[model samples]
Target: MRILVVEDQDSIRRMIEALVQARGYEVTAVSSGAKALDVILTAPHDLVLLDLMLPGQYDGFEVCRRLRADPSTRAIPVFIISAMDDPESRRKATEAGANAFYTKPFSPIALLKEIERLTTGKG
Candidate 1:
């Protein structure tokens, strides 16, 4: 399966990439929301691991909204991995069409389990 990881932090991005790659899935990572959008629009992916506070014009919320709005990409699963842990952020993420949300300092095991569940229909 293919997974797109969108994170602005260089270290965090690399860590996520490594984690997902170790799971035997293809990973395409980007440092900005704009780049994420461009990549997603150009190609297909099984899942998207998005960070809410992103650089450039499109934040993670907008990215999710756009993906949901587009017929071609509407079915793609979006899992938010962000530092925003407040109820408002969670609500906004849900409203924006995220399938799941994991706050920062999240359990890697749990995240991996969710990814497995989303991509292969197995938890």
Candidate 2:
């Protein structure tokens, strides 16, 4: 499966990339929401791991909204991995069309499990 990971932090991005790659999935990692939108719009991915606080005008919320708004990409699963842990952030993510939300300091194993479940329909 193909997965797109959008994160602004270099270390975090690389870590997630390595973790996902170890799972045998193709990964495309980017540092900005704009780049993420560009990559995702041009190619197909099985899942997207997005960070809410992005470095561009289009944040993760906007990206998810756009993806949901576009007919061609509406069904793509979006899992938000962000530092925002408040209810408001979670609610906004849900309203913006995220399939799941994981806060910072999340369990890597659990994240991988969710990724597998979302992509392959198995836990």
Candidate 3:
């Protein structure tokens, strides 16, 4: 499975990349939402692990919305992982058509398991 991880934090991005790589999945990690959109537009990813807050004008929410709006990419699975652990954040995720929402300080194994379920149809 190919997973695209969008995280602004270097450490966190590298950590998630390593974790996903260990799971035997192809990973393409990007530091900003703009870069994510660029890659996402160019090719299809099996799953997208997106962070809510980003450094660009288009944050994860916007990215998610665009993905959902585009007929070609509307059905792609999006998982929102963010430090903004608020009701509003979760609401925004749902509005943007995210398949799952995860807060920061999340369990690595749990994330992996959920990714497995989404991509492979089994956890």
Candidate 4:
């Protein structure tokens, strides 16, 4: 499956890309929410791993909102992968239409399993 990873941290972004790629999935990584939007709008992605903190005008919440608002990309499954591990952040993520929520320093195995579940409909 094709996936888009929207993360600001260079190391985290690279790690996520590597992990997903190793799982035999195609991945597109971007450092900002705006760039992510552009990529998603132009290309089809099966899933999105979005970070709550982003540089530029829009935060991850806004990014998720925009994705959900667009018909072409609204149905895509999105998992919030961020360091914002507060209740409010989780609420906002859900309100923004995220399929799942994960905090930073996340378990790689759980993440891989979640992605597999979301992509293949098998948990």
lDDT of each: 0.94, 0.94, 0.92, 0.94
Which runs in model 1 stand beyond 4 Å of their true positions?
none
TM-score per prediction, in order, is 0.97, 0.97, 0.96, 0.98
Model 3 lDDT at residue 17:
97
Please report the TM-score between candidate 2 and the true structure: 0.97
> What are the per-model C-alpha RMSD values against the true structure?
0.8, 0.8, 0.9, 0.6
lDDT computed for candidate 1? 0.94
lDDT, model 3, position 77 = 94
TM-score attained by model 1: 0.97
After superposition, candidate 4 runs with Cα above 4 Å error: none
Pitting candidate 2 against candidate 4, the one with the higher lDDT is 4
lDDT score at residue 114, model 3, on the 0-100 scale? 89
Worst lDDT window (10 residues) for model 3?
114-123
Which digits, one per residue and each the tens of the lDDT, describe model 4 over residues 20-119?
9999999999999999999998989999999989999989999999999999999999999988899999999999999999998999999999999998
Please estimate how well model 2 matches the true structure, expressed as its whole-model Cα lDDT.
0.94
Can you list the residue pairs that collide in candidate 2?
none
- lDDT, residue 59, candidate 1: 96
